[model samples]
Target chain A: MKFLKIIFLISITFSLYAGEYAVVVNKKNKIDKISKKQLKNIFLKKRHFIDNQKIVAINVSANMPLRMKFEKSILQMSREKLNSFWTKQHFHGISPPLTQSSTNSVKLFVKNVDGAMGYLPKNLIDDSIKVIYEF
Target chain B: MSFKLKTILLVLSVSLIPYAVIMILMGSTLKKEYTENTLQEMQTQLQLNVDRIEQYLKTLNRDMHFMSRMDVMNDIYSKDLDKRISYLLMEKKKDLEIEGDFYLFDKNYKIIASSNKNILSDSKKINKFIDVEIISGFDNTKIGNLILDFSLKNFTKFFSNTKSRNYYIIVDKQKTLFLEKKFSNALKVQMPLKNKTNIEIVLQEDKEVFQNILKEYEAWFYTTLFVGALLISLIALYFSNRLIKPIISLSKAANIITNKKDYSYQVDVNSNDEIGKLSHSFNTMITSMSNVLDELKAESENKIKLLQEQSKNEMLEELSSNLSKYLSPQLYASIFSGEQSATLSSKRKKLTVFFSDIVDFTDTTDTMESEDLSELLNDYLNDMTQVALKHGATVDKYIGDSIMLFFGDPESKGVKEDAISCVIMALEMQEHMNILHKRWINKGFTKPFKVRMGIHTGYCTVGNFGSENRMEYTIIGSTVNLASRIESSAIPGEIFISEETQILIRDSFETKEELKITPKGFKRDISLFSVKNENKKTNKIILNEKGLSIVYEPDLQDATTKKDLKKTLEEFITKLSV
Candidate 1:
């Protein structure tokens, strides 16, 4: 019973923190501003190029509020609809956006890698990361 | 395998395999065809018609959706929210011209607007609306529900607008209490139920027409399969019977052959195909085999019978030969001539055996004419043999001129008596041949011949000898040898008997003592006797008139070993008187 209570508390805690994600870009890159539509379009694989540079996209985990917001602003569909769509896309040899676990990992990835794009929470964002789009 | 068993198996399998396979295959195919024709096609067509009905329902549903979104309902909505709701019933009717009655309910499910004037009409159909509203709540984009009454009363009023297609609408959201047919006003009713209901759409012309077509197709499919199966079965059965007719007859013939163990049964010959050829071959083979078997059986029986008869004949011949050869001629010849003869059994009686041969009768006959010499010797032999044979002396053999005679078989009249008879017979023969000498003198024949006979008696196996093939009925043993030696040492007409014979005849003869004669197969002289009659002195006068009573020197009997005793006696008188 105690273990169950702990599990229940952990799920609530994850749910509370679910929507808190920050989009991260390389800190050294000068070009910065991006629209939510462009972010959504890039991550959903609907548009390939952004601001004349090929866009790189990433994802939050399944059922997370950030993934929901990402779907509404980008794919413009429910998660079930998105799943069915990706099922079709995978059949056609296309894969969805790359995902990462923690915002700190996204920040560290953007800092060390070129052409890498990802998201984390605002508090986890730092000088090594630049936010291109935030919701 | 026996030829018959192999043939039966071959024929049965040959006939049965294809037939069984064809029948089983036909039965299975017939069943398969029956199921496909009856159910599978119906299921496929049923799914097809169901899909058409679903399509129709979906299209009507879409059209009703478009009607719900029309401007006219909105125009009333754009007006008042209260008094407008009541007048809304009439106006809503005009607005939704395609339906029987149109009604509106607030989000709280209270009747707000209606197209029926029975102001209680909304309550009257409240059940239908309440059921529809409950289902509309969970839908995200859906606003309100709509119901269309397609009862014929209203349907006939708007029939001109929708006359292109024939359809029926049923509102089952509220339970149906009654239905009245427009054409006949005949009502059908059902048990009512509380709201939480269903809707049904019925198409009369197109659906019924299609249903009739489907029903007809079902009927046609079933009837066709039945007819086809029946016809095919009839045709197949007819052909099968026709095909098996010859086989049945053949089977009957085969059964007969098996039961009877006779190969004579044959199948009927018809065509020149496989079956016909088989029948013909069967007939030919069976007939030939039957003939062969019959002939073989007859031949074997004949051979057995013949062998049995041949064996029996051989046995008979052997039996006859045994009977003929094993019986002593002493008895046989006498018995053959029907003579009353007896065998003398001398258990302790003394007897003698005799054997003699001519010195060289073969050399004499070589110089003489064979026929003349034989006649001359036969005339001499006749008298000597008769005397010996007549008095019960067995004339055992003649070796040319010499006579070997024995007493004591074919009846022994006592050995002493036989000796006495033999001496008297010799004297009488000498007298009798003087007459032949005179007759031969008148005919001027050659000099009268002399022949000698020897007699001895002792123990001998005076019986038959040799095999069934060649037999000699005579005596055998040692006593026969002594008599032969004594006779061969004697002169013609001289009486020479062994010491055994001398002892037997002492009373009959005025005996002379034994004179030993040698070089006649004896180491010492053997006693021989001379018989002198009481008129011995006048014997020369009788001898002169007839011939001489010649004293036969014992040595002359040795020379004329096989000469007749009678002729030897006749010539002896002339020699003795000299």
Candidate 2:
């Protein structure tokens, strides 16, 4: 019981200090914002298009702290649960979102692809991409 | 060369040489064609393998291009965060069964996605066996390049290496891969990969392997040629023997015939070919020659028989000529003419018989040398015979120095003419004795011969009289005896004729009555006459006898020679009187 209390206390402390992240697309995208549910659907491959255009979702690598924070804050799932969900979705001919090793590559990916979107730290946002959602 | 050897050579030349040449030509042609066809097959196989390699490369290039164009390539912008492109590349590499890796490079030439995980994120160059541009699907722009690190082992699935055939890769005409063995005298084929220009597929087929097969075929072909040559030689021998056998026998027979001079030799005929015909013709020629020789022998024998007959006839002619001296010419002619038969037979005919005697020939021969006497006697008889023959009298016989003759027996003019011929012959014989007496005295024989002749014509038996083996052609009976008696009574140099002969000869000669005598068998005395030549005159008288020879020529003698002759005659008369 004491080991579980210490793990809960450390998680809450990390959540208080976590930096804000935004889901961004190329600057040429018309969309200004996205609902959290829509972002979830896009990342999970449940929704394939946005605003009548095919959408490509991007993610950070699995070992990234930002990826863990995003999964905790928005996916509301653990790493094991997300991995099992994507594994199940693979049978349905649906794939998880593309991943990048760093926030810089994630930003570069969203900046280059027109219908591509990816989450990044807010401080790393640049003029090459547009923020469609912030958290 | 002998006929058999010649024939064998002919057959071998005709049959074997051309056959051997054709066999060699065919064997060489077959080997050449087979080798060409084998090379062609090898080339076809190489081309098929090359085609498969090209097709595989095309498919690989297209697959690479298709993968590069996939929507999943959009993830290259995200650096394949989901590793989807790399997974696809690995799957293609496995599907191609290539011995190389597939890698996706970003714009900076950094390997972002690769089938080989160890090479992930490695920086690489654009040089590769095959490469394709990675285009972002949403932006429609080039993002990176997909490349393959190709290995020569990848062509192993298309072609494999064997003892006789080998496959390899040549890169840029310098770099050789896969099999590195150097091949000498091999068939080499190379083609560049369509997608990889620097890479070539090289196929080599070792010619030594095909050469080995060709050598085996050549050995077999030569063996067959040897066997064929042997068979041809055997056939040549058999045919030469068959063809030359008759000719050899013919030669042998010819030799035998030449040496032995025989024409009965023949050759055997066994076939209906030309040789058989030649043998038959040879036999026919031999038979014809034999027949001709036989005819020549027969003709020659006939010629010899004719020659012998001719020689016998010549001998007979010579013998008859010799015998003619012993016979009267008329009798010899009559016998030769087939008119007279030599047999004991007689005919009664009026024959004028003549008789002559050398008076005192015996007494003269006793006084003279036998040689001189015989010479004188032969001279006298020869002269007498010539005279008698001139008158056509047949001489009957000679008893010592006496000769008996007749006419009208073998051939006669009637009895009157015969008697006249006989008396004339007797007168001629007395006259010829005068010539003999002169010849004898000149030859140193002083004694001369005196001949007395008598003739009579009467019916007498005149014919061949004697034994069958020994016969005389003569006249016999009283006419012959009376003629002898008349001859004895004749003066030494006188001719006396009986009355019958006188009557017959009176017309041809002058006759005077000499005397009359009754012969031993006569009943009355017959008057004898002396015959004288009518045209001759008595100019001289010659009397020659034994111990008495008087020749008085009144006109030729001078008075002194006449007195000397008269003295010799008177002395001879005194010697005769004593």
Candidate 3:
């Protein structure tokens, strides 16, 4: 049991250090991966087409840990900074990406919709969606 | 009924019946027209409200479609994260004064942005009144939907709620909105929204409210009709009385004339109508009748006066006929024929007068009862008067048992003829006295009257002579007194004549000388002569003894009397022989 406990602790520590999340899209999308800049531009409504297909970006609810990680790693902005940016973009007739209450709903939305994109934990990603980017 | 009452009834019927009928018909027609017109006006107003609500709903649908097509709707691709589309929706809600909110939803059924921010989530879905899909501006792709939450208050600008009239919404023909209670007895108008067919707008009006307004109109109409009827009745009464007055007065006048039977009463004429003419004619008739009655009364009085005069004349004629019994026949004839007047007047003409007496009448009457003496004297004078009247002598008067007569005054022969009639009348009177003596013997009167007669012929005054009040128609001269004295000197049962009378009768009679004596009224002694019939038949036989006396006249007896006298004499002879 001690050995089993030690192995469980090591696995926990490795998972903490290497807990990766992936940006995903519908399996029918032509793209295998996405750049962080392209993701930022698509989510911010600046770039609308990718590989000749229109892009739709989605997010989990605010205050979600994965949403915070996505903002920190991909959007490269704090929550306050993103909110201020969207507030400014509202004046320009621009909107932020779509949001859902849970990561599962974000994943489901991205898997069913063409040119749809959302972020999820790598473990939760399945064959129904393609991994376009990782963090 | 009285004429006035009849006239009043006629007027009321003539005026009021038609008036009441017209009023009832007009009232009913007006009531129907008023109700229909009021309902039509209400329907028109409700239709106007319905049109306004339909216009409002159409505009709302158009506004939702316009907003969905706008560039701001691109924010739906970002799930309206910047709140741009929601801001526009909030502005439109404010401008429309809606009680609902607007929402934006993505393809995941997530609420992207909403005017009500708390509803912005994937778990919240709104029931929409208006919905439009958002398309991408760059790729022409549907990304999301813009929706309006259904609110009954959204139609408040088009509808104003009142006690009787209210507006409500019916969703899906099942749920009623914006209504406090459901009404069963209400008039309703409904129209569905053109954009949302399941939503309906309804307008309701209370039927009882309209009915109350109609009832008020009915009350006003009936009151006016009643007032009009009252006015017509009063006018009828006034005209009826005015028309009947003259006829009433005429009837009253006719009644008075019949009751009192006074034709003098006249009706008063007050107008130139037919009744006035009738009164005038009635007065004229009464006047004429009164005049006729007066004329009848005067004619009756005149007839009565004529009848009274006739009765008086008849009475006077009867009185004069009774007076004629006391006068001589000659004098009565002369007076009735108007030959002599009844006054003390005498005329001197030659009149022959004669006188006769019952010899020793006083001695004979003193020995008998007065009744028997009067009977015997009337019998002797009646015989003397009969002989004198037969010889045409007028009997003047009777003094006791004497008779005085005259001739040649009222109806005269010659003086010689008058004197001869007097002597003859005296001889006949003497002869009639014997018959009177025989009648007296049959009456058992032993003492019979012996009458003596005297005659004279001389001039005497004759006419009515005496005082004016007492008149006798007789001669009044010495010749009358001499004749009376001559009658006294004659022997019983003898005829005596004066010398003048003997001279006038000597040719027709036999005469013998008699004693001459001077009369008291004569100046010389009057020579007297005894006169007898010249052809006298002596058929009388008489016998007298100490106890028996008999006398008879054969020439004066009929056969039966002769037989009775012979039988009596033979019986007496036989008794004397015995």
TM-scores computed on chain B for all candidates: 0.32, 0.71, 0.48
What class would a CAPRI assessor give candidate 2's docking?
Answer: incorrect
Top candidate, metric DockQ: 2
Predicted candidate 1 versus true structure: per-residue lDDT over A1-135, tens digit per residue: 999998897577556533455677777655586666767667777776655555445565565666666667546888788788889988887678655443444455457444556766677876767876555
Off by over 4 Å in 1: A1-135, B1-98, B101-351, B355-368, B375-399, B405-451, B457-499, B505-527, B530-578
- Model 1 chain A poorest ten-residue lDDT run: A100-109
Worst 10 residues of 2 chain A by lDDT: A10-19
Q: DockQ for all models, in order? A: 0.01, 0.20, 0.03
**lDDT tens per residue, model 2, B1-578:** 77788889999999998998999899889988997887687678778888898888788889999998887777677677667788888898888778889988888887888888777444544347788998875456788998988876778777767888888888889988877567788877777766667888888888888788889988999999999999999989998998888888988888988999899877778989987898899899999999999999999999999889888878977888888778887788888887888888888988888888978888988998898778877887787888888878788878889998888878877777677667667766767767777887789888667788888888899778888888987778988898899989988889888888777656456689978888788899989888876532356554433334344457778999889988987997798799
Across B216-298, the per-residue lDDT of candidate 1 in tens digits comes to: 75676567656655666566555556566677777878889889987867788877878787788888988998999999999
Q: Which of the numbered candidates is closest to the native, going by highest TM-score?
A: 2
B317 in model 2: Cα distance from truth in Å? 5.1
lDDT for B177 in candidate 2 is 80
**Model 1 score (lDDT):** 0.55
Model 2 lDDT tens row, A82-133: 8899899989877677666678777877776778888888899878889776
lDDT of 3: 0.76
- Which interface RMSD does candidate 1 score? 25.9
Q: Give per-model TM-scores.
A: 0.28, 0.66, 0.44
* lDDT-sorted candidate list, best first: 2, 3, 1
Error of 3 at B523 (Å): 26
